[model samples]
Target: MAAIPAPLSHTVAAIDAAYVAAARNGDSLGVSMSQVIHPCDRALFYQFRWCAAPEPATGQRQRIFETGNVYERRLLDMLRMIGCDVFEIDETTGKQFRVELAGGHIRGKMDAVATGLPEAPETPHVVETKSANDKSFKAIVKGPVRETKPEHHAQLQLYMHAEGLRRGLYLVVNKNTDEIHAERVEYDPAFCLAIIARIERIVALDAPPARLHDDPTKKGAVECMFCSARAVV
Candidate 1:
C-alpha cells in the first residue's frame, strides 16, 4: 500500500492544484474550492462581500450613507485622516483571495486597508469599523472587554496576515450616539494558526457545516448579519 501524505502536505498540494486549475480555466481558485467544500455557504458569502464594497447597483450609496451619517462619517473621516487607504472588493475580485476554514470557509474584503505608512516605534495599527443600530452598538461597546470581538479580530488578523502586519487598530461607532472609540490590538500567531487549521479541517470535511444563522443574537449574529446568506437562509 502507498504511504499516506502528511495532512499539511496534502492540504497545501490540494490548494496549489486547485489554484492551478482555476488559473488555467480563468476561474477563481477560492470560488472553485467553495464549490467543492460548501456550495451554499460560498454563494451567500459572495453576496455579502460585494454588498459591503463599492458597487454600481448601490451606486456608491453605501459610501454616501456612511459619510452622511454623523458617527459613521466621523469614523470614516478619522480613518482617512490617519492616512488609511480605503478601498472596496467586489465579489469577483474577492474570490481570488480566499482562505479555507474548518467545516466550511471564510473570506473577506478589506474595507479600508492601509500600508506604507512609517512603522511606528510601537506596533502598527490595523483598523476595522462597523455601523450598527443604537441598541446593538451599545451592547457591543459594553460587552465584556475581550480586546475586540473574535470575529472582527479574525477579520483584521486575516488582513494583517495577508499584509504581514503585526498590530491592529479597531474603530467601532454607534450611529445613535455618533460616538467613536478606538482600541489597539496586537497579533496572536497562535490564533491565526488555529484559524488556518480550522480552514484545513473545513476543506477536508465530507459535508458542509450547518447553515449559518442570520439573526442579531449572539451566536447567530456575527457572520450572517452582514452575509448574503441572510437573504436565502
Candidate 2:
C-alpha cells in the first residue's frame, strides 16, 4: 500500500491547517543567514529590497524542514548523552540562543551552545547540526564546508563572530547511515565584515540589485527554473 499523504494547504481541515498556516505565514518575516551566502546576489537583494516573497513552502518541503528540526533535537540529546554540556535552553525564559542583525532585519538561532565535547574539549563552541542523505553527506565529508556549501559555512562564521566564540563545532549526520561528520569552524573577521556590508547595502537599496545570472532566455540557466524572484528580475 502507498504511504499516507501529508496535509496540503487546500485539503486539510481548519484545526489541522492552523499550525501549518502559521508556519507558512511566519516566512513572511525577515531574512536569515541562510540566504547571506547564496551564490546569487540578486536573489538575496530582491528578497530583502522589497521584491515579492516566494510561494509558501510545499508540504513535502515543510515535512523535510520539520524532519531536520527533529534530527537537530536528537543530535543534541546524543551530544548530552555522551557527556557533553549543552545550553540550548535558557532557564530564565526557556528560549534558544538567538542573535539579531541590522536591527533585527536578519536573525538566526543557535542549534546549541555547547562545551566539553571530546572534539573541542573545554571551549564554549557554537553547535550547528545538519542531516543529509548519503550522497550529500559524502560530499560534505569529502570537501571543506566553505567549498561544499558556502551558505552553511558563512552562517557558522556569523554565529561564532556574533556570539563571541572563536570557533564552532559543525555537526552533520548521514540520514541513511546515521553516521556523523564533525568539523571545527573558526571565525573569519574579514568574511563576516563583508557579509555585514552586503546585508546593509541590500537593506538600504530602493530598487532590486542586478541579477546574478542573465535573463532566462539569454542563457538556459537552471536556477531560473526554481527562482521565486525571477519575475522581479
Candidate 3:
C-alpha cells in the first residue's frame, strides 16, 4: 500500500482547522468542507438546486430528500467503522476557507493534514457520500474521472488544487438498497477551466439566469421538497 502523501497530511490539518473555526460561528462551514474534501458530483447537484430553484415542494418529497442527510451520516459511520479519522470542522471558519477558493487558495491554522485510514495507510482517498442522486454521481464516474464538473468543477478543482492532491474517491449510497457505490477520480486542468467558465458567467451576469428558477410551480420538483427557501417562496 502506498503511504499517505506528506502534503496531503498538511492539507487535511489546514482544512480541519478551518472547519473547527466555522463550527464555532454556527455557520455552514461543514457543508463547504464537504465540497472541498469530497468534491462529489452530487455536491454540484445541490449547488444547482440552490441556484436554479431555491424552492420546490414538501410533504413526502421532503422526507425522501431528507434521506440525503441520513445517508451521509451513515456513510460517515461506515468510514469510522473502517477506522478513518472523521472530524467536524467549525462552520464559520469553513466559510472563510471557501471564500479563499474564489482566489484559488486554502488557509487555516493546522498543518500535517492527512486523509484516509491512518491505520491502513494506502493511497489517500477522500470519500464523498451521496443519497440516490445517481445521475450526477454517474456523470462524475462515467469517463476518466476529472476534478471539475461542467458547471461547478472550479470549486472542486480548487479544493484538490489547494490540497496539492491528485485523486479523489466518490462514495454514493442508494437509499433503497442501502448499497454503497464507489468511484475514483483524477485531477484535470481542462475540465477545471470549463467549470470555472460556468461559474464566471453566473457571477458576471447582472441578474440571476432565468433558467435557474428561484420558485417553480411544479409540484414534484426536487428543489422544492427540501430547500430552506421553500417558506419564503
In terms of TM-score, which candidate is strongest? Answer: 2
Worst 10 residues of 3 by lDDT: 105-114
Q: Write the per-residue lDDT of candidate 2 for residues 1-233, one digit (tens) a residue.
A: 99999767564455345545656534434578788776676777777654767566555566678899998899888989988999887566689887777666677887878898886678888888999999999999976898997888988888887888888888999999999998888889899888887787777777666766666655667666577778763
lDDT-superior candidate, 2 or 3: 2
Q: What C-alpha lDDT do the candidate models reach, one value each?
A: 0.51, 0.78, 0.46
Q: What's the best-to-worst order under TM-score?
A: 2, 1, 3
Candidate 1, superposed: residue stretches over 4 Å from native:
1-74, 82-105, 114-123, 143-148, 208-233
Q: How close is candidate 3 to the true structure, as a TM-score?
A: 0.48
> What C-alpha lDDT, on a 0 to 100 scale, does residue 199 get in candidate 2?
81
Model 1 CA RMSD to the hidden true structure, in angstroms: 17.7
Cα lDDT of model 3 by residue, 1-233, tens digit: 99876555667666555544443222331233233332233333344345334333433344454567678768767777876665434355652223233333222221112256543356554344556655655554554333434223333344455556665555566655566766555666665555454444443445434323434457655645544443432
Cα RMSD of all models vs. native, in order, equals 17.7, 4.3, 15.7
TM-score of each: 0.49, 0.85, 0.48
